[model samples]
Target: MPLPRLARGASGRPAAAPRVRLPREIKVLLAAAFVIALGYGLVAPVLPQFAASFDVGVAAASVIVSVFAFTRLIFAPTSGSLTARLGERKVYVSGVLIVALSTGACAFAQNYWQLLLYRGLGGIGSTMFTVSAMALLVRLAPPDGRGRVSSAYAGTFLMGGILGPVAGGLLAGWGLRVPFLVYAAALVVAAAVVAVMLREPRNAAGGDGTAASPPMTVREALADGTYRASLVSAFANGWATFGVRMSLIPLFAGAVLLAGPSTAGLALAVFAVGNAAALTFSGRLADTLGRKPMVITGLVVTGLALGAVGFTDNVPLFVVLSVVAGFGSGLLNPSQQAAVADVVGNERNGGKVLATFQMATDAGAILGPVLAGALADRLSYGWAFAATGAILLVSALVWLAFGRETLIREPQLQQRPDGTA
Candidate 1:
């Protein structure tokens, strides 16, 4: 597929600027991402409640949630190796089918142990597809359009995430197991779409069109300062966004603000709204301006806003800060992913490199809550929020000091015969 091109003026002259037009394969990936995220969201809101229904205590029920992330972290290396060996399309399809089977099994679980086992198995599949998907994006995205592609992809998942929970709540009226069945069906549909529509890129060949470049290794990738800095920022992002936001925000809303469940849900919804607003333009800025500036700016904005969140007693102020924090995250994500793509380039497979980066994020998500919760218990919620904010700020400092901009300027980008830049 062709990358984006400059539109022509009325007189057939090239326009002064180029516009990003996503290639067909990326659109396919985006479609599959939406389905996958929507299905996952359907399961997420109800998973704890479903586990509790098995006559388990709160701690045990929460463990069901933790185990999935734990398994994803543990199995990531293996997933990377599989993606490298079998290719992304194969791993992606196989991974989706495995998750589908596991989710369907969850619907039929007769006991807590069964549910736990099924959910844990789903994590293995999650890492498999997640790693392959990143590798595929690295391969397929047009060089100049990587940020825009990442943004569109993230936006689709965000839209699905915003819609899925509401739908899951309605489906729960029917039964908890119904959502699992529905999620399983959604996974099957996503797998079918990708399996049918997405074609794997042929191996990068030499002038003779016979030999392919070797896959990029993690060791080689680590030599780049940008990748190393990205790991720090990725960890901070996982810590603040996935871990603390989900775990701490609701508690703060209920305990500190003395708000109802609806209020807490509203805060989350507003964050998503702010995130959507930023996605509208941040990607284009990243593509046109630079990745480093976006990353640093996002981290600073998120840190400052989130750090102040615990100091505020007013509900309106809390909600506004949440929105600001979400906006910062939206600005950060696409540029971060695009920078990684730049490092990997289009010619070489980077499954292991991508997996290692993913592992850093997963590790932060796994550890952040446990540590922050302890701080909340011993110190205060303020300390927990501040600590998370501090981590983000420190990461921004790392980027400022050491990170390199990875966006390839037009003059520097070289297009191959295959039309890749």
Candidate 2:
């Protein structure tokens, strides 16, 4: 039997859809992310230099390193709530708008505090777009294809991370403020693409079935064990990935590997590439294998690999470790997202839970640079990086010790004759 298109109209009822065929909207969904990444990346390498240009000390420049994360962490939980009240499409678009305006504002800033304000505003946009985009991905996808769907979204960001540095370096060579201009332009392009190409998926709206209502607050989602575990896993992953990679890795490359800034950048890019390549496979793997195993394994191996990266002094060793760490990170996204989807399935509460998860991720992102940089200053980059890895290892073990898989072939978990809550 033939089925309806993946994106049905305004009605919330998802019509029966056919077996796996990638929807057109997938490209639309991933489009804004590329623009966002490019703009952020263009200025990323030299943000400290920009602050320093204003006569600020290294300590003040650190805000350029951390404000983005701080703002995101604060706003992530709110994304879902806002989206549920609105809709995924509006939230996603609004986010792009915010980033565009914020970047434009940054380009004109002449002082340290002005730049800080702009960067913080951009974080709000990032959170708004991410939470809604993710919720939409969950809703649009068929149950069987959830992993790949998320893998595609995750992969987009990964690819963006790859391109950001190469682009950032070249643009930074041109001018301190050119990157911001480039970011604004790229965002315009992304906004256009999403608007023209993407069509909203109606079925994934709100919570549960048409009869059910989405939770009004983030507090509601936290009360559930399954949701809570997913948040913890995401936070652990983000802390290890974002915190260590941006803050401590470059130092490790220069000090231990005897490399330069470019080498350090390449090492970071390798991590993104590794995760992106893995996404090509992990999506299908998640469908066949399920989500928790992938999340647990990703957490464990990433930690171990970070420890190895810290321990090694050789350039070749760092490269290999970057690839492995990225693969581990690649595993965490789809599995954790799928778990969120399992609980959020057929529920409009997608916005609420997605927001909560983003907060966890944001918290990690916020903590990563500041905390890692602090540790590096006090102790060593190796210690700063390794500690995050160790944290992941412990977090993974906790999940495996007590957490159970959220989704198994739906048939196996179907309710039996007995009434058990």
Candidate 3:
């Protein structure tokens, strides 16, 4: 069915505000995201801990986390269409409520299956919230400023990476369920912020300035050739960046540096630092350099970093390589998202595109680890890194061979601090 032709996006605007201007609307969005991130992070580290309580091993406990990713993979396609139909204001709020209730239920979970059920439910709601947020950023932020604005949104996850572990560790010590309750409260606060602070009455109208209607479903989203390519690219990127960085690198560290898991953790932290640092500038560069430029650069460099990791026996050398690889990761996300918005066009479709992309994320994570795991069991950790690196390189080649630059309506011009146009 056709979506309602309201002139506005689900964000309740024709498009988001300019990237150059940090408005109250954007702040509310970011603030809510921060709260959500905090709540979510507060429990993340303890997933394994929580599951172990039921006498489940590490692998089964991991399912609690993986189940969420898998569920999100399923929901991603529909999330965009739902946003188009219902509008972000409604979906975002309801998603938070769902997360709250689901997480709260886990507190009462008497068994591993119950915990898995609740976590999976929360995962569904998470897709709704995440997709809605990304969709709104695409709809609300102007074309030229997309890279920059998207950077801010991406930064939230990175920030959460840093803080969530610490918070989760502390809260879990208090009791596993205690963090779940705290997370619930945090979502409520985030929901209230959105309800009260973020409003643009004009955008309530869909394409024709009428009532918002549902946009295309995942079925329609998958039909698009360009969207499919983006998903494939996302899979390649995720598999290489995450699967290896988390699982394979430690083995390499152990082999080369004679260090343990702690060293591998440090290596991962270094990669994140590189990602965070690059994000500070990469977004602006994407605006100036074009989205495709960053995309290609990110892919090529990340692949090279993975390749570099294979050659290194020196710990410091690998650290540098890890940083480079992380920077590559930082560059990949925003540019790809901007490209999705470009191909799909702004409005409710942004939500759907993100959902599809997230599926690729899950696929990469699931498959990457399996592939890496197999390589490790059979050959060596080195082979695993090399294989992922090769895939990264292949991703770049594919993009260069077939990937097209997303059409930007405007050339983002840099302005002098003096305000010279």
Off by over 4 Å in 2: 1-19, 196-212, 216-220, 256-258, 369-386, 408-421
Model 3 per-residue lDDT tens digits across residues 1-421: 2222223335453333244886677778877887787777788877778888999998898889889877877877677677766777778888888999999888889999999999999988988888787777766776667788778877877797688778888878788899899888888888888988876323435548687644546567666544666777789887988666776788778876788888788889999898998889887776655666688788888988987787788888988999999999898878877777766555444565577777787789778988887987898767878888888878777766656666444323557799987
TM-scores of all candidate predictions against the true structure: 0.93, 0.84, 0.86
lDDT of 3: 0.77
Q: Which portions of model 3 miss their true places by more than 4 Å?
A: 1-19, 200-228, 255-257, 407-421
Candidate scoring better on lDDT of 2 and 3: 3
Residues 224-339, candidate 1: write the lDDT tens digits: 88899999999999998889888899999999999988878888888899889999988887787778889999999988888888788989999999999999999999999898
CA error at residue 142 for candidate 2, angstroms: 1.5
lDDT of 2 by residue, 119-237 (tens): 89998988898888887787777776788778877777767766786788898888888888888878877877886787655543423555545444556666656677777777777
Q: Measured by TM-score, how close is model 3 to the native structure?
A: 0.86
lDDT, candidates in the order shown: 0.89, 0.76, 0.77
Per-structure clash totals for the candidates: 0, 10, 17
* Highest-scoring model, lDDT: 1
lDDT of 3 at 412: 34
- Sort by lDDT, best first: what order? 1, 3, 2
Please estimate how well model 2 matches the true structure, expressed as its whole-model Cα lDDT.
0.76
